[model samples]
Target: MPRRSYDHYCAVSRALDVVGDRWSLLVVRELCSGPRRYSDLFADLPGISTDMLAARLKDLERDGILTRRKVGPRAGTAVYELTADGAALRPVLDSLSTWGTSQLGERRATDAVRAHWFALPLGRAIAQRIPAGTATVHIGDSAFHYVITEAGITHHDGPAATPDLELRFDLSTATEVATGVRSLADAIERTAPQVSAP
Candidate 1:
């Protein structure tokens, strides 16, 4: 299929021309963490059809937003990763995440939840206090870690090998922190949540 565009000269329109689509920014969101295998992106997105994912990826790759590469020590597989231009979308994601927090009041019957899904908000929240370093968030059977640097934040699917700090909490508490309703400190004080430093 041919690509769609705003077909205008305005700056905002030009920016949107690259990222404006139903699942486009979200795909950028997934890649914000780092490189992801095609299967991983499909799985985490939830509800996105395979064809839709493929097409969006193609568009993104064509636009210089992301690149497809063969990864692994051996028996390599394909992974999609953000380009420098794509990584530049970090602030955009952060802004959107902050704005979207208010709308995240409740999870619907069809809503999907994953620890890493809250990475953006939590990473922002963590950045406020720590500013820099790595944090591993362990929630139930799942986990995610993020490294905050001078540039911006990038998350990983699982725990950091040597995290500066670790936060272990359940799902509800994770939601509370992510939504800005309750802070990690407040949650720790109230529930005696596990917080470790190494």
Candidate 2:
């Protein structure tokens, strides 16, 4: 068998060349929800410094993976969004998110940790994990019913008994696990979350 070289493969190399950096993949993930300006992007990614984000955006724009559009006449009011080619990566991003969540869910060991889950992709993914039927979820003091239907999981706000599965964790832990920062295994081993049997 011949040795595979990244440099020799145009297709593989081209994909990497476009999203070769560490933050580039995260940039793609952030844009998966929708388009946003640089400020919004930066706000979501607190750990990323301004200069580094600027560089990554520039590189992505140069590689045609992202498009920078002026929002208005005001200077520095530009929104960076994924191009058509970049939009094609949605499935890949979704798969990554799903895999990360599964791993985290499996890793959560104890039954006492609290998780503050963010909306959008993570919340949607979490909704899919419940057994198909009528149920409710109690995260901390909050509670929402998980009504399984042909469409998907729908939340109903009403007075309900203790949920079948109770997840507890702080805001940072929840976001970290949801965002793939802390694997479920790591959270279980570290934070010790308890997932009740349904």
User: Which structure among the candidates has the greatest TM-score?
Assistant: 1
Q: List model 1 lDDT by residue over 34-137, tens digit each.
A: 78999999988999999999999999999999999997888489999999999899889888988999987788988888777788888888888788999988
Q: In model 1, which range of ten residues has the least summed lDDT?
A: 187-196
How do the predictions measure up, each by TM-score?
Answer: 0.91, 0.52
| RMSD (Å) per prediction | 1.9, 10.1
Per-model lDDT = 0.87, 0.60
Best by lDDT: 1
Q: Per-residue alpha-carbon lDDT of model 2 for 36-140, expressed as tens digits?
A: 799878876757899999988888787777898887767658888788878777656656656655565543444333222243333454555654555444445
Q: What is the lDDT of candidate 2?
A: 0.60
Each prediction's total of clashing residue pairs, residues at least 3 apart in sequence or on different chains, is: 0, 12
Stretches of candidate 2 off by over 4 Å are 1-6, 73-76, 102-198
Give candidate 1's whole-model lDDT: 0.87
